[model samples]
Target: MMNRRYVPDLPEQNALSEANFLRLEKLLGGLKNSHYDFQWFGRNNEPVQVHAEIIERFKFTSTVNLIKQNSALPKPMDRVQLTIRMYHDARMAEVVTWDSGRQLSGVYPYPNDRMYQIDEKAQANVFLGEWLAHLLRHGVAEREWTPS
Candidate 1:
């Protein structure tokens, strides 16, 4: 019996990307505004900040960083960072590179280089969707977001 390796569903991945793009676009106020401070409480009830910023605009490159200012080296949660690319024409968004500075491939052969999961790209996009959802749920923008 041959082991069934995972194959990516391009349509599903694209759908996720498309949904994420709309969520992010709304979060960024139609990509007109930049900066969302996602405030959440730590175990001690201290406020923590998850900062989202539009670092670049041409084709919309953005970075979401969770580092705390004036603090020591961040913990893994605090160190989560993602470099995202937004394709307005395609109405899609993707994680171009992750905190480890590695680009996730669309599909990977089982036991392939770096031992990445076969559906890494789709997983990353799903992760991005969750992040955007969390931000939309708890984030506070510099200005109120309203449909324009």
Candidate 2:
């Protein structure tokens, strides 16, 4: 592996990203307003709320914000907040910012400044996929529920 070069697996990334678009749509499609609230009893039957909002919209793209509210998970996981850009034209969504952090890069130099994983971008997307799937799997849409 001395001479091996890093290459972005565009195909795999594309597939996961594309699938995430669908997952997002499934999560956000039926929302009656710009903001949506939901609840899911995950992990020890504790109530975890999810907040989703359409933060921006344009001709062929939209920005969405997702956050876990009242989560019982540990740090970072419990603080999962993301602003995703949905490319309607291309039919996929990618995380633009995580936890309000800097713009996510597709690849990072190993042992870099932030101690991030090499495939941070891809991992973000995958994390999003799992989050969305969890929302779809267990979330119950709230029409007028308030966080408590």
Candidate 3:
């Protein structure tokens, strides 16, 4: 079995940073249908391949790190880390985050928007897009990462 611990102030950590979000805005502002492949943890204990359209006009903010804890799965899984608003909606200041090590923890609001419920399909699209951008900019080479 896995251990799950709740941490305080998860929302603040996941919110997007200002500079990064501006970069996203610029990219999305001029985006064309470019195909990009990126990998991230899925709800299951495995890597997931995400494919998305690179919109070049949408803006994104930045993210903050939250708690680091283990997953609820057995051995061989990575710890779940939380981030505060990694992205903000242009129309509204909605904060979103990417929760590590947990499956189905897609882009979500951090109690900022009182009535705005996250649509899973939409969240997946946004997550895939934002995550792809992040990986392309910061992902370590596959050859460099070795299992500990």
How do the predictions measure up, each by TM-score? 0.75, 0.88, 0.25
Per-residue C-alpha lDDT of model 2 across residues 1-148, encoded as one tens digit per residue? 3855568899998999899999988778733357888898866888888888888888889898998866577765676689999998899899999888999988888889999888888889989998899889888988642223
Q: Give the TM-score of candidate 3.
A: 0.25
TM-score of candidate 2 to 2 decimals = 0.88
Sorted on lDDT, highest at the top, how do the candidates line up? 2, 1, 3
Q: 2 or 3, which is superior by lDDT? A: 2
Show how many residue pairs clash in every candidate, following the order shown: 0, 0, 28
Please report, in order, the local distance difference test score of every candidate based on alpha carbons. 0.68, 0.83, 0.38
What C-alpha lDDT does candidate 2 achieve relative to the native structure? 0.83
Candidate 1: 10-residue stretch with minimal lDDT: 64-73
Off by over 4 Å in 1: 42-44, 59-74, 142-148
- Compare the candidates by TM-score and give the number of the best one: 2
Please give, for residues 1-148, the per-residue lDDT of candidate 1 as tens digits: 9988676787888898899888878876675655555565555666656666666667534443322321333656556677777887888888877774777777888778677778777777898899788777876544433223
Candidate 1 residue pairs that clash: none
Predicted structure 3: lDDT: 0.38
